[model samples]
Target: MYKVIRKILFLLPPEEAHYVSLFLLQLICSTPFTRKLLRNFFEPVKVSPITIAGIHFRNPVGLAAGFDKNALHLRELSCLGFGHVEIGTVTPQPQRGNERPRLFRLPADNALINRMGFNNDGVVTIAKRLKYWREEVQPYVDLEKPLIIGGNIGKNKSTSNEEAWRDYEFCFERLHPWVDYFVVNVSSPNTPGLRALQDRSFLEKILTGLQKKNQEMKNPKPIFLKIAPDLEWIQVDEVIELVLAIGLDGLVVSNTTIRRDALLTPPNTVSRMGAGGLSGAPLKERNTSLLAYIHKKTNGKIPLIASGGIFTATDATEKFKAGASLVQVWTGFVYEGPAIAKNISAASPV
Candidate 1:
């Protein structure tokens, strides 16, 4: 059914199609009758519990950060059956992202390239909505064992690289209470000069600042770093060092890659879609290798939340065998539709 719907959705502009699909989810999951009925469409199957940092997730498959920029779909998304849903990459203030045509679909290769530069309603607005979820919806959703929520934080576009840590600090303080864990996103290609924060010195400083605040908190949540798949080998080594030096809780094995190679889509089509992060099947090998490499360097000391081209159960299994404690889905969810979480988990080693 989703594949058929995907065929129809594919015809529309990718951005429009995204909104439409979310609308349908909101529409169905909002109604009590529809919500109950739709539950049957998504069957829940227990794989195994995954413990990372200090919390336990029902399954290893999670929806990656960019999918739900704000916490708007918390209720609806949980209904789609993801073990966890990461929201944000949200900034200090809301900003209309780059011009449209920012999201492009490459169906030929089951991938997507997006330059949707941290487009979100900022932290304040998102906090208000999040408060409602945290206060009202989340409690009722089962606090004893509620669905996991991760806050993926990033700085605003206007912030200079020198003052960037302030932006991350601002967001960390605000989202600290609501989210279950944190992913410090400094690797997005869409944001100008943002990737520069990946530098070992700067990244250590940023994580150290956040870690200090977390330690002071009455309740400190797990904070992880999200790095770019485009990093050079030396850069990866720097990251491994940073993770160990800071004692960061974990690492999300990637954001997206800027390098576009072996894409089934023609160069002309890709060139027209210019300037965005490439994610999907093209990312599977690199993402898996990254996890393996990081595991080897860290000696399996740091936890890893693998993200990249997870289109099927096989792709997910590779991540698990490679050393990922958990896995996140982005391009797969877009191309494979809602059953993806269940589909992947059903066949995973976990």
Candidate 2:
């Protein structure tokens, strides 16, 4: 079972275990024989199909952005039965990100804290990979439905707030033809002063620029804003207002939170782990509350993609009840293993 494999993986360092797991999965998925066997074991489950932001999803469960930052594992991950897979918080240029020991696991709280700082291959390289997928690889998968891909983008750490729009625009333009949708990420806590761009004036500027560029495309992709859970109601309201005013497609109802209150993980241990956004079970209450609030405020008119703390069918159902049209998983996927998407999709409400 996954618990046994997880125990072995847990013995390794968090970040190391991640790459090892992905590498193995990538290898398994590379060959059609292994890929078919894996897909049979973890078959896709179609629950209530829904269309959000003009894209049709075979199911509501999706892989959250941070899991596959460079679009490397889309073929394999899709076999695990996610309706969508979002890649990147990709910048215009590749980044080294923060120092090592940046990712920590809190088994007691079922949470992870990461100051990864948008570490990823830059837009150009990632776009090339995607181009191959579209032209060469996609024809082979032959699924019943197409997997929706979301491009989650942000600025490089060295980029200033004033010049941030250029970075976002660069990514938006480059990824436009390849990705099914786009998420503007100005909410990550790891990047210094990045969250400042979430302010109404600055957000308007960045989003409007992306939207303008998006319109120039013969087929403009759906654009969504990924917001932090730390924002106050007033701030969230302002975001809703901007979303409506700009005619943006939707919102991803949170990134990870910087707050670390009430965790079962001891204070000393948590302090040792240090600064980064905390995600997983500890995030459930706050994440769902924010979902409900956003749903209520927007009168359930604006589509929402719920992230944070979803680990089970019940969790996905809770998000649906709270007004999320789609749900994404990152920490849960780490904990629950590859069967998660299939399991959650099977258990989802009719």
Candidate 3:
């Protein structure tokens, strides 16, 4: 069924098809009856609930960040049976991001390449929408428990690296009240010099600053670092050092990769779509290996959320065996449709 729908959607431009699909989904899920029906479609057989970073999740399969940049579709998406929905790589202020044709489909590779830069509705606007969900919509849905929502935050593109901590700080403080957890997004390949924040000094400054502020709150949210898959083993070790030093909650094992190695897609075709993060099937091995390495390096002390290239229950089971406590999907969700979560959950071991 999804193959047919995807074939039709593929005829449209990638980004256009994305909005059209989401808009249609939003409309369909607007009604209580429709939402309920959609929710049960391919709903997973029960999987035991697990707690991660002090939050309860019905299952480990979650929609990754960037799929719902504005936090507008959590209610609708949650109904699709994801254990959680992470919203945004949202910035402190709104920005248009990279120019059009920024998103491309590599059907041959079963992947997507995007230079979307962190295009989003900004933290302030997003917070207002989340407030409504928490205050009004969630109770009405009346699920067994509140759906987990992680706020994935980043600095505005215009912000220089020197002052980037302020931008992360701004979003962190603003979203602290609305989200169940936070993910600092410094790994996006589209954002200029953004990955520099992964440096030890810069990371220490931003994470420690957020942690200090978190301590002041009546209730602080769990914060995780989203790193790029392109990092070296030495760089990853630095990340491990920082995670332990700051007592950070966990790590989202990876974002997308800037590398384009070993793809089934034609080189000329991929070169034509140049300079964006590549994500999907090609990412599975690197991401899973990184997950296992991190887990082993940290001696499984740091909780981890696996992201990148998870397209099936088997892929997810591999991540679990690699030491991921939770997992998220972006390209898989795009390629496999809403049932990706339910299918993976049903196949998950209790």
Per-residue alpha-carbon lDDT of candidate 2 for residues 238-340, written as tens digits (9 for 90 to 100) = 9999999999999998899999999999999999999999999999989999999999987998999999999999999999899999999999998999999
Clashing pairs in 3: none
**What tens digits encode model 1's per-residue C-alpha lDDT throughout 1-350?**
88899999999999999889998899878776776566556645757778899888978889999889988888777777778999998899998899998999998998999999999999988878888898888676546556799999999999998898999999989888788899999999999999999997789889999999999999999999999998999999988888888889999999889999999899999999999899989999999999999998878999999999998899999999999999999889888889988888889997
Model 3: ten consecutive residues of lowest lDDT: 39-48
Model 2 residue 219 lDDT? 98
What is candidate 3's lDDT per residue for 92-200, written digit by digit as tens? Answer: 9998889999999998898999999889988899999999989989988845766899999999999998899999999988888899999999999999999999999
Which residue pairs come into collision in candidate 2?
none
Residue 274 displacement in candidate 1 (angstroms): 0.9
What lDDT is reached at residue 62 by model 1? 92
Q: Point out the higher-scoring one by lDDT: 2 or 3.
A: 2
Compute each candidate's TM-score over C-alphas: 0.97, 0.98, 0.98
Error of 2 at 318 (Å): 0.5
**Ten-residue stretch with the least lDDT total in model 2:** 137-146
